[model samples]
Each structure stands twice: as structure tokens, then as C-alpha cells.
Target: MSQTHSGTDATGAPVNAPEHVIVIGGGISGLAAAHRLAGAGVRVTLLEASSRLGGKLYADEIAGVPVDLGAESLLARRPEATGLAREVGLGDDLEPPAVLGAALWTRGKLRPMPKGHVMGVPGDLGPLASSGVLSAAGLARLPLDHVLPRTDIGDDVAVGAFVAARLGHEVVDRLVEPLLGGVYAGNAYEISLRAAVPQLFAAMREGRSLIEAARGIQRRAAASAGGGPVFNGIRGGVGRLPLAVAEACRALGVTIETDTAVRELRRTPHGWQVVLDGRALAADAVVLAAPAPVAARLLAAESPAAAAELGGVEYASMALVTMAYRRRDMTRLPYSSGFLVPPVDGRTIKASTFSGRKWGWLGEAGGDTFVLRTSVGRHGDEADLAWDDTDLVRLSREDLEAAVGLRAAPVAARVTRWDAGLPQYPVGHLDKVARIREQVAKLPGLALCGAVYEGVGIPACIASGQRAAADILPGIVAAGS
Candidate 1:
């Protein structure tokens, strides 16, 4: 790989030298890019806007335990997150949650999630019928799914509309919205069915009915002779994975600047010019691994089309309240991992996880202490986000008490707010992404990657980063030729 540092000394004349690459943002996506490039023998520099390295994958020491403030779990079925963990030598740290069961807070009670249900759409009705979470009328309403006509609109549709059309409105309001609400932190009325659950939609497109598709899936699983895997988390915390990645990047001799934020980018006859603080740095190639909005601001002037397309993507704010309590003070303890509250319930909290119960190692073994994590706010729920930490904690505590009958005040508490955390995959999201890609392809030596494009989970972010690295490395190597 070529290495170079060149700019105007005191005059405005350009100077020629070997090429070096610069990556904007130090999140997982950016870190992955820099790590990949440096491992391939390319001189790379990584710039982060914050004083710390991890963007959303952040953790802090609380009462002698590491508490994750951002992402907390990874899907075992997704290989990208697991593969990256192994590459960074943190694979041994992988740990599964203690409980595989989840509950739903509905009709003034906490009910266990029905078995054989994939995100609340029952693959097997036996469990749904017996679960008692829904009324007999609701259960009777489900069979209507088989008679619903196939939607042949050939255009993007909202998740709520799609679910209500195929399944009943009860399923959309009581199940799908809340389950998906926990994932995307957005309203199901606006979230795109194609972008949010492409597999489910594909099943509909192929089988002509959700019931048949679900039955087909169940038969396939039974034929495999084993059930699917459950969700997993790290033994220590989710932050450990990012820390390991940072360590590996450092060992590879990649230059990481934590407090350095790239403010602007200007294209030159040679490659690209980046402005950080008040200084300008030139690079042969640039990879924008930041959030869509942030990346849009940087490229607004250089590539108008790309900037407009990127700016079109929307994001919402989310907040998490983590609290610890004494088990003796609580009258009832849920047997499941925790519960999700549907919007129809008119609850302030979206979901709550029994951290100590969900994962065996999260709390002291056979101890009296327990930890619970609650989430709040979304696109239209910014009022909750605007609340002070104290108010937020109070509101969450009240909601927990009513929903689960836990009367004790928390022994320990911490609140973390993300102004624009989860990206909203609104209707026509895939088409917008396609347009963004088309515009990005028009610019040479430039690549964009992050959760905004493909997925919003840890695995998807890792995949985006690796894909960006693959696209840029060969060009960096060939530039020297």
C-alpha cells in the first residue's frame, strides 16, 4: 500500500506524495474499516467525534460491575457479530442468556409469551390458544389470516398495515407493534414491512398466506431434528467485544484519534481533503462509517445527490433506565426474561428486561439483588426523552410497579439517553437506499457503511463495515500500481 502526506506548505500549490487513507467516525463500522485496511498493509487513520472510542457500544463501571449503556445483546444466528468476536479473540467470552422465555404485559397482567411464536406471529396455534394472554375473541380472530387475500400492490407498505391486512388488527396492535417497537424504537404505522421483517414478507409473497408459511416453517424446523437457537449476550457485558476490537486495531498499528471529528470533506484533483478541527488532511480514499445524518452533513457539498439521499433517512431517540433492587422487597418475580408492553396498553415504557434473571451471571448467584433494564421513547414519544434523569427514573419505576407489581424502590439506578440512536426504516426505505447507493457509486474512492443501510443490530453493523473495507482495500492496493 502507498503511504503519503501532502498539502500546501505556505502557498496554495498542491504537492505530490504517496497516498494514505482516512476513515471518519470511530464506531464499530469505522473501527472495522480501519482495522481491515491496516491489516491489509494500508496506512489508515480513524477519527472519532467523541473523547471515547465506542460510539453506541459504550459501557461504564457501576458499583464494581460493567454496565452497558447502548447495545446489550447479539443474535446467535447472525454470523457477522460472532465472526468478528472470534477475530478479536473475544469468542470465549460469549455467553447465552439464562432464560429463553419472554412475557407480555397485557390486560393488567404479565403473561408468558406463547411457545412456537416468532415475534408474536404464531407458527403453532396450540400455544397461542392456551397462553391466555389474548382473549378467546382474539384467538378466534387469528384464523381469518387464512382467508385474507394476497396483497399485490407491488409497492412499499407500512408494517401495521401489512400485519393488520394479513393477520387481524388485534395482532398488529397487541403484538407486532410492541415487539417491533422494542427493536426499532419506531411506530409500526410508519415502519416499512419490507425493511423491518423481509423474511415474513417474503413468506407471504411465496406461500400466499401467513398461516401456511408459518406451518411450512414449523415443518422445516421439525425435519431438522433440532430447535432453533436462543438469543445470547456476553458473560461480562456487550462492551467487551468492542474493547477487544479496539485492542486488535491498536496492535495492527492503526492510528486512532478519539477526540478528532471530521467537520467537512472537499474533493480534490488527486483524492479527497478532510477538515478536522481547523486542520486539513488529504487522503487517497475515504470511508464514511458514521450515522446517515452525520455522513450526510460531511458530504453535502461534495456530492449533493448522495447527501440528499442520505439525509432522507430518519432516526429516533431512545433512553434506557437500568436499576438494581433487593429481591426480598418485591412480592412477585417474573419467571421469564421480562415483558414487552404494547402501545395499546398506553404505557410509557416499551420493554423491560430482567437483566439478572435473563442472564445467569449478571447478578450474584443465589443472592438477593436483582437488576432490571427498561427502555422508553421513540419518534413520536420525544416527551419521555425530554424528561430529566430523575423524572425518567421515577416514571419507569412507576410503570414497572403497575405492570409487574414490584413495589420496592430501586437500590441503584442509572439513566442513559441517546438523542438519535435507532434509525427508522420507514416505508420505501429500500428504494431510498438503492438511490443512495447509486449516487455513492458515482463518486470514486468513497464508501458508506453503517446500520442505516442494511440492518440496525450489532451483526449488521459489522457486516456493513467489513463490506466497506472489502470495497476500498483493493483500490488502495492498486493505487500504488
Candidate 2:
């Protein structure tokens, strides 16, 4: 057990005690934070309200074969996620997608996704026009972006509104919304330009047209990235990442407890007192890695200002319906990884991923069985989620039949619903995050991290955790001396 002291020296200075840090929440973010703190030789205790770890990254069996029911891939371009995977002994298991490129299911057909676009804001109109993704009038109006006056993006603006003004509604509705939806599960018209796509926002601030900005971004990426795979996954499942991280933390002597809810948090003269159901734990520092609402409730009495800001952060709910089928039952397989559906098409499902085709391991493991999954629900359009699991699977099959001529029945099906899965970023979300951080910083030994901050991606969440660990380390080091 770590030594806990609650007194001051003769000079009124805080008495030194061995650093004991507590991390609330057992998601990837919390695990990452605990790993970092433990690596620094601090005695750390991680508490989770749930029975299991890996909040959004979960793996399960479908038809006697392992499959990822939650997040299946990681952005290979980002180092945080991939780097963490390597650190946790998954270095050799990292596998890139077997297939690449996807189609956009719009206009009653599947059109090849156009090249040279930043989140579907076309840089080269030639491919966009040839792709048949837009109507004649929409194609003609695209050039108007070059002639429009510079719109004042005072503090922040909506991604859809800015792109619609510079291009037109067709572009935002057909391309931007669907692409952004895949990431945020929120309407582009409501998402923040500054928070969602900072690079595009920066380019626009320099007086360049959206087209030029997108082209430049593509060119720079091509030159610097050397055409590496955009995404990567583990051989078994990306969901195994958090489990591996937790194991590494345990090896380092970090204490992790699940099904343990933290009821209250109070600041002590020396550090903090974390109140639970029957007892309390003392720590030199605390990392709040819970979701926004949970964090708000825990911090209400300690930091009301920060709690209010966290309370304002909204979230989007979603579900993934996974199904497995016999390969012989299908007449043809999807050529690419998958396709994204535009909401304007009035589809029940938002997107589908051909797991067997996308992941080489899954294909080889399944042998005669083919697997695929479809996502349902979004920010404001979650009525579909109210349906039961069987209904969601049925609705998914109905759309799959229309989108890809998939009429065969599956051998097994599973529905994984992530209620409030992703955090939504409104117009001034970045500014709001800054205020929340400022308020938390005022309280010594308190720091925050999660999808509610900079981003919702796996890498972003890991980076957020690392940042929180770094923030409180200095205080812990000083008190230990």
C-alpha cells in the first residue's frame, strides 16, 4: 500500500508522502493513464464502474469465430494507438487492411469514392463529376466556390454551413455529411469546423478556396506519408488492445478494480479522498477518465465550474449489427472494404464493413464463413436504435440486400449497441474544452481526459490519457520529495 499523509510541516508546507494516484474509469483512456503513471513508479489504483474493461473496444465470438463487435481498426497514421499497441507486445500482430478504397451509396447506386477530397470536399471536380455522385446542377454550382467572397469565420463555424456556402448543399449533403458521419456520427451542419477539421479550417483562414486547400492537403500527405496504409488492425481484433494494456499495467504493479463505482471526490489538505460504497482511498493525484456526464457528476462538489462545462458536452449513440454467412451462399463478394450510406438516401443503416474482405486474419480464420457488419443510428437520428436487436438485424439485412445484392440469410448475427458512444463537437467545442481544462487546472492534482476533449478516435483518446498523466506527474513528484 502507498503511504498517505495529511499534515503540514512547520513552514506550512505539504508533508511529503509516497505518490499514490487514482484513475476512475477502466476504458482505454483510463488504462493508458494508469499505465503511464505506474511506469513512472507511482503507486496507482484504477477504478471502473463497469464489470469489464475496454469500453468501446470489445471483442466477441460470432459463429464460433472471433470478431470485433466494437472498433475494428486504428488510424495507422497516428502514433499513439499503434505505438501503444507495440508497447503492449502486439507489435507483430498489427495488420493492415487487405482491401482498400470504398464506395459511396448515394443516388440509388454505389459510386466509387472520389479521390483528392478532405472529408468529401472535392479538390478535383473532374473525378467528383465523373463519379456520378452529384447532379448536373450540383456539379455546375461547384465552381462557384472560387468566386465567393471570403466568409467571416469569426470564432468558429459549422462544417456543413461553410462548405455549403463555398460550394453548395449537394456537396455537403452527398459527400461531406456522410464522410463526417462515419467519424462523428453527427450532422456536419452542426459539427464545429475548427474542432472537426482543423487543417481545413487553417487553410481557409489563409484566404484559399476549399478546393485548393483540399488539393494542397492531399499533395502534402502524399509526399510526406509515402503512400502508407491509412488504417491497421490486430490479427485477432483491435478490441484486444485495451486488454493487453491492462495486462502490462498489472505487471508493473498497478492495482485495477472493476465493478467499483466512485461515489464522491473530495480535496484533502494533503491530496484527495475518493469515496466509494463502503470505504475511501487517498491519493496524491486523481485522473478523471470517465465519460462527460459521469465526470460531471463526480466533479460537481469539487469543481462546479468544470462540472458545468463537462455537463454541456453532448454524445451520439450508435449500434453495430454483425452477421456471419456461408461463403457458398453468396453469389459475389464486395470488391472493396465497405461502403458508406448517405442519410439523404433515407437508409436505415449508415455504413457497412466487409470484415472478411477487410481483415486477412478474419478471412483465413473463418474458412468457409464470410462476415460483415453494419452500423445504425447517429446523433439526432437514433430512433432506429430503439428497435430490438432482432429488428436492427432485420433492418440491416433489408438495406444490405438493396445496397449490395446480399439476399442470403446469415448463420449467426449479433447487435452491439453503444449508447452515447461518441461525443459531439458543436461550433465552439474547442473553446468549450479550453474552458473546462482551465477550470480543472485551478484545482491542484486534478486533470481530465476522454473522447469529450480533442477527438473521439482511438489514438486521440490514448493521447488524451497520456496528457492527463503528464499534467499531474509534476505535483506527484514534488510531494514525494
Candidate 3:
């Protein structure tokens, strides 16, 4: 860990150092990079623009309990994030969701998420047949997917179009759209299917029928030991994971400077020059792990091609309202994790999670306390995100009352707003990403990684960071040799 005011090498040499690296952005990606570099014996400095670390990994105490305002959970099957956790000695802290149940708010009622439905696409017909979430007519409409002819268009297509074409409009509007729409805060009509759900696309390309593909997957899993475990989170809160990562990085002697924003990056003859607080720091390698737009601005003058492509990626704004109330105030607590509301419902909220029921530790035996997390916003409804705290809470409360029978005032309430947080993978996102990668590869001693490229979840961010670290460390080692 080195921070030189004069931007010179350790030997006080005015020349460029062989193994000096600077990682911009102190989020999960930046932390992962700095930690990896330090572990590999590379001198690294991580710079963050915010007053505190964890850009979108924010957590604060509410009513004496930790509440996550940003990312809350990680899919266990995503090895990158979970692998990082284990490496950082936080593996034991991981816990699966107490209750695997979830609901869908439809037709002005709360309905359980159809069992055996992987992310809203039915894997088994039995669950869909038994699920009251959809009518028998809607369930019958799903079999149409088997007969749907394959389309050979070699261009990006919206998720909505793909779902509607393969399945029925009811499946898209009632099942797939709202569930996925809430996750991305994006419009299925515009979001790219390749970028959003590549696995489903691959299944379609390979099996010709989603039902057949899903059945094949089930058979394979049953024949084997079993499929991967469902999603999991930290026992305390999702914030603990980042906190542990940051701590591990610090323990490895990585210098983390929060509130130090990197304004620009310039290519020098030997290495790179980074501008921050009107001061410049020179390093052998630089990693831009910030948001796509921020990264674009930093590299605009240095790599115009990369910057242009990065700037083209779009992001959507979203808001979360977590409220705590007495369980007795509600009509009945469903044995479900949470519920997703379809956009066609014209409701103010996109989805609502039964925080207390989602996990066992979150609730008590015969206790009356319950916490609910409600999300608001999508591509067309950006205005909802712009609402002030008062209005936001009011709107969320109104939706809660209609979705779940909540009448009592919340004992606790908090609102978190993210401007341009959720990345929208519009049609052709992969092509643009390819171009960006090509331009990035042309630049020596520079790497780019973040949620905008591979995935939007924590696991993807960690994977991106680790991959960047892997790329930068070898150069450092060879330079030192």
C-alpha cells in the first residue's frame, strides 16, 4: 500500500514504478481488486469518491438492527461472490433464506409463487396446475410454448417479445414481466433477452421448448446429487459481507481512501496519470470499477472509443421503502418470502418482500413484529423514484394496504433512493459491450470491470473485480521480475 503525494516511485524515483496499481471506486468491485492485488504483493491504492466506502453496498442501523439499503442478497449458485466470502473467512456467516416461499400480488390479491417455477417460468407443470396464482386458462396457455417455432433472428430481442412469442401474453404480463421487471427496474419490452436471461435463451436454443428444457434440467438434477442450493444471505445482513471484504483488504495492508474521487485518467509515456482533488497520481496500472457513466467520463480523454461505448449503456433509478409493523395488524401473514406485482396492475409499487417471514431470524416465535420491503420504479415510471421521502413513504403505504391488509402505522420506516443504480441492458447491449471490451484491450495497463457488463448482482461484481485483478497482477509480477 503506497500513497505518494509527489506521484513518484518508492525509491523517490521520478520515473514510473513497475508494479504500482490504482483502483478507482471503493465499492465491492474496487475492494475486490485492491484486496487481490495486495494479496499478490502488488502495491495498490483504492480511491472512492464518497465520504464512506461501499457505494451501493450501504447498510445502517435501524431500531437497533442492521438494515441493508442497497444490495441485500446473493444467489448461492453464483460462485464468484460466495467464493470471495469464503476466501475472506466469512463463509460461516452465510445463511439460506428461512422460508423459500414467495408470493405474487395479482388481481388485487396476494398469491404464492408457483412452486417448481424457476424465476416465473414453470419448470414443472404440477406446481402451475396447483398454483392459484394463475387461472386454468392461463395455465393451459403455457403448453403453447412447446409448439412455438424457433425464430432465427441474429439480433438482440426484448425479453417481453421473446416470452410473449414463446409463451402467451398472459405469462409475460402476469408472470415473467413484473417479476423480472422489479428486479431490473426495466421494461421487458426494451431490455435485451441475452443480457437479462441468457440461460433461458440457451435453453430455448438447445431444447426448442422451454418446458422440455426445464424438464430436462429437472431430470438431470434428480439423477445427480441435486441442483445447487437456492439463494442465501448473511445471517446479520448483506452489509456484513462488504464490511468483511473491506476489513480483509485493510488487513492485507491495502490503502483505502474514501471521499477521494478520481476525476480523470491520462495516458503517460510510461504508465498512467490519475487526477483527484486537483492532484495527479501516477501508477503502472489503473482499474475503473465505478459506474459505466463515471468510468466513461474518467477515460474519455484517454480512450475515446472505450468511453463512448461505456457512455452508451443506460441505467435506471429505483427506490426501496422498508417498513416495520406488528404482525397482528395484518389480516394474515402468508408463508412466503415476498410478492412481485406486475406492471399491468398499475400499482404504485413494483414488488414487496415479507422481510420478517423471508428469514427465520428476522421473525420471533409468536412475535407480532414484521418488516416489509417495497420497491418502486421501472423504465416508464421514473417519476416514482423522484418522489420526496414523505410522498414516497405515503405511496408505499397505500400500496401495502391494498396488497397486504396493513392498517396500523409503521413502528419504523426508512427510504433509500438510487439514482441510475439499476443498469438497463437494452437490445444490443452485448454488441456494445463487445465493442467496449475491444477498445479496452487496446489500451495497455488499463482494465475495466463492474455490474454493467456481465451481471448486476453482487456475485457478478466480485467476479468482474477478481478477473481484473487477475489481469493486472501478472503484469505487475512480470514488471517486477
Candidate 4:
């Protein structure tokens, strides 16, 4: 039974109106959906299992300077994230990185990241050769791609296998592995070509040189957008995006309750009933935005096929170690933003970001303090994650010393561990996602959205949420009438 209240629709006549919507999960996706629903004059209630609203988009302070503890930037080429930031009054705060360019800490030295490459698949051999990221034999093997037979990619293929067949294993190990690992935290050879990098996969289907395909992608993008900044960040931290969206939702009369986990979902004759500890809330429409496991549990009874698929989704764990050091002590820091380390090199950390140099706001806030962060552990390489925070921080410091020759002890160090944070998109991931979506669609007034179904970036999550909200709007309106 929905608790309806008196309200006026369009013409000003008082009527019992507005369908109730219960959005499970209070992360960016759920908050975005609730905001849209409330804006459309639907009664919205959002529930989160955790104490916080932002999931991976978290913010904190280190040595009295504000910083993002989670994701640091948004893909600006995609409008969803930046547009939502502006909608919630963060337009002026959208900023591009102050420092540009990154290097690879491979071959026992720092090498400039090769230009004209899509995720480390080089389109031009000149830059790759000059960068010295690959061995002499590796460099010689790349020309073979022009005359090599097209590698058959049926429904899907691993990014590493496909690239290696055309190029060489050295390119996959030295270049592609580290670059792709930074995003998925999974082995490049295990990740899906179609799901992970759709544009490159589509080009591969054309049966031409992989280099030409990458060049075409680059040229097309440059011509269309004039090579705009690929990413953007908020003035303070990207984490603040969810907070601002939550605020906007509240202003629109959305009821948000944190630490309120939904126990189960039951389909009723009129609508759906959301079960909690001792009470049930009726909703005309529902959006399931929790992580895969939690979403699986809630949908097991109603949609077993979707639940099983969601349960099978694999996740990768990683840790971020952020340290702040006195600017006076940093004598040998690299000029670039930071660098990525190939796993084949036997390095403890995968990547590092110079927060102070990359984000101007952080640099301004820190004053004499220089802040940077290092990431460790990935899907199958998570043994080090079991180590205590102290160990993780020490390992990070050691890698920093070896990479940039900086031995100064940090004034303050912080370690953040995300267990099972990133989901892996293996071969046939697109088909799996399609099956899950199909099974869920069979249930009326229900939809699902999160990092599981589509891309895992900020803009992608927001777009998924917006799509979910749009999907249920018509059903919600009809139910209320």
C-alpha cells in the first residue's frame, strides 16, 4: 500500500497523486535515479546499506588538505558526469588537469608514454620505438602486423591475445598490460575485447592493420572534437559529486535513508513490496542499483537467472596509498604527472598519481605539502592486499624511491583498501549482460543499473542510472493513475 498525499497536478486542482518509487542503494547511480524521479514529481525514497552515499567516489583529507580517496577524474568527452555536476551547481568547479602526460616505469627506467596508441596498442611505430618501452626484438615484430593474416575474433576475444597476435607478446606485457590493468585491475589477456574497448574491436572486425585502425580512431576523434581534454575533475574532489547530487535530490523532496538495507523484494498484485527488518514499503516502481552480490540476493526469488549471472560477476581488489611530503624534501621528482609499472617487471605497485602536480586545487591547498598516491594489487594478484596498512604504505614508499629517486619520508601517510572494488569484463561479458537484462525485464516495474552492466567510469554509471529512471517512468505514471 502506497502512502499517498494530496498534491496538485499541472492545472492546480488538488488530487491524490504521485507514484512512490523506492531506489535500492544510495550510491551515485541510485541517487541519480531518485533525483530524476523526484524532479518528475514522483515520491522517491532511496535506501543505502552503508553509512555513506558515495560508493567508490569518496573524499577525505590528508595533512589538512582536501583530496579524493576514490576516483579522481571524469571522462569529459562523455557528457553525463560533467553535465550532472553542472546541473547540481558545480559548473564553475569543473577543471582539467594542470599537469599533462604520464610515463611508464618499465625496462628499469622511465620512458615517455608512446603517442598514437589506443590503450597501448600503438598506431605509429616511430613513437613506440623511440619510447624504448619494448625490446629490440619486440620493436622488430610490430611490422609483421601489416602482412599477417587477420586473427579471427568470433563473438569476442581477449584484448591481449588479439593485440599479441597482430603485434607481439612484448607489447602486451610491457605496454598494454599496465595501461589496461590500471582500469580493470585484471589481466589484459582475460578481459573482453568487445566489452572493454568497443571501438577498437569494431575496427578489428574490418580486417585491416590494427595500427591503421588505431590511427583512424584517433583521426576521427580529433576531427570531431578538436582533441579536447579527455577528462575533467571538480575543484575540490570528484567525490563531492555524489554529495551535491544527494543535496539536490533532498531539495526536490527525495527521502534518503542511509544504513537502511533492503532485505528482500516481493512482487505484489498492485506493485512491489520492499522488505526491511520489521517493515515493508510499497513502491509502484523500483530501481536496483546495489553491487552485484547484493543485487543478486535481492533478486534471487523473482529473477533467478539474473541473480545467478550477477553472482558470477568477478571483482578485483586493490589498495591506494596516499602520502603527503614536504615540498622542500622532494628534490628528484619527475616532471610528468606520474607513471605506470608493468607487472612483468616484478614491481609491488601498479601505478602512481602525483596528486599535487595533477590537480591545481590540491597544489594550492597543500602549499608546502606535496601529495601523491600509489596503487597495489589486482584481480589474481591480491596476496599483498592481505598485508596490514603499514606494510602497504612501506611498499608504496619503496616503489616511489626506486621510480623517482625520492627518499624523503612522508609527513603523513594514508592507506585506503577497496576489497572487490572493480568488476572484471571477461570474454562474452556483453552477452552475459544482455541475458541478465533480459531476465530482469520480465519482471514488471523493475530495472537494474550500476558498474556491473556497462562501463565502470563515472559518466557511464550516471548514464545507466538515468536510463533506469527513464525506463520505469511510464509504468510509474500508469500505476498511479
Candidate 1 or 2, higher TM-score?
A: 2
lDDT of 1 by residue, 180-260 (tens): 888898888899877887766677766467766666666665565355454567767777777778889889887788888
Prediction 1 TM-score vs. true: 0.91
lDDT of each: 0.77, 0.89, 0.76, 0.88
10-120: candidate 3 lDDT, tens digit per residue: 365554323788999888888888877887777788898888787677867555555677777887766777777887887887777775677788877887677665446
Candidate 4 lDDT, 246-302, residue by residue in tens: 999999999999989899999998779999988999888799999999999999999
Off by over 4 Å in 3: 1-18, 135-140, 153-155, 218-228, 327-331, 364-369, 475-481
Candidate 4, superposed: residue stretches over 4 Å from native: 1-18, 475-481
Q: What would the per-residue lDDT of candidate 2 be over residues 1-481, giving only the tens digit for each residue?
A: 3444343444767654348989999999999888888887778899999999999999878998889989988988778898889989999999999857799999998899988899988888889989999999999899998888865677889999999988899999999999999999999999999999998899888888889999998888778677887889998899999999999999999999999999999999878999999999998889999999999999999889989999988899999999999988765756898999988899999999999888999999999999999999999999999999999999999999999899899999999999999999999999999999998988887888889998999998998888888777643221111
lDDT of candidate 2 vs native?
Answer: 0.89
Once superposed on the true structure, which residue ranges of model 1 sit more than 4 Å away at CA?
A: 1-19, 217-228, 365-368, 475-481
TM-scores for all predictions: 0.91, 0.95, 0.90, 0.95
Q: Sum up the clashes in candidate 1.
A: 1
Best by lDDT: 2
Ranking of candidates on lDDT, top first: 2, 4, 1, 3
CA lDDT of 173 in candidate 1?
74
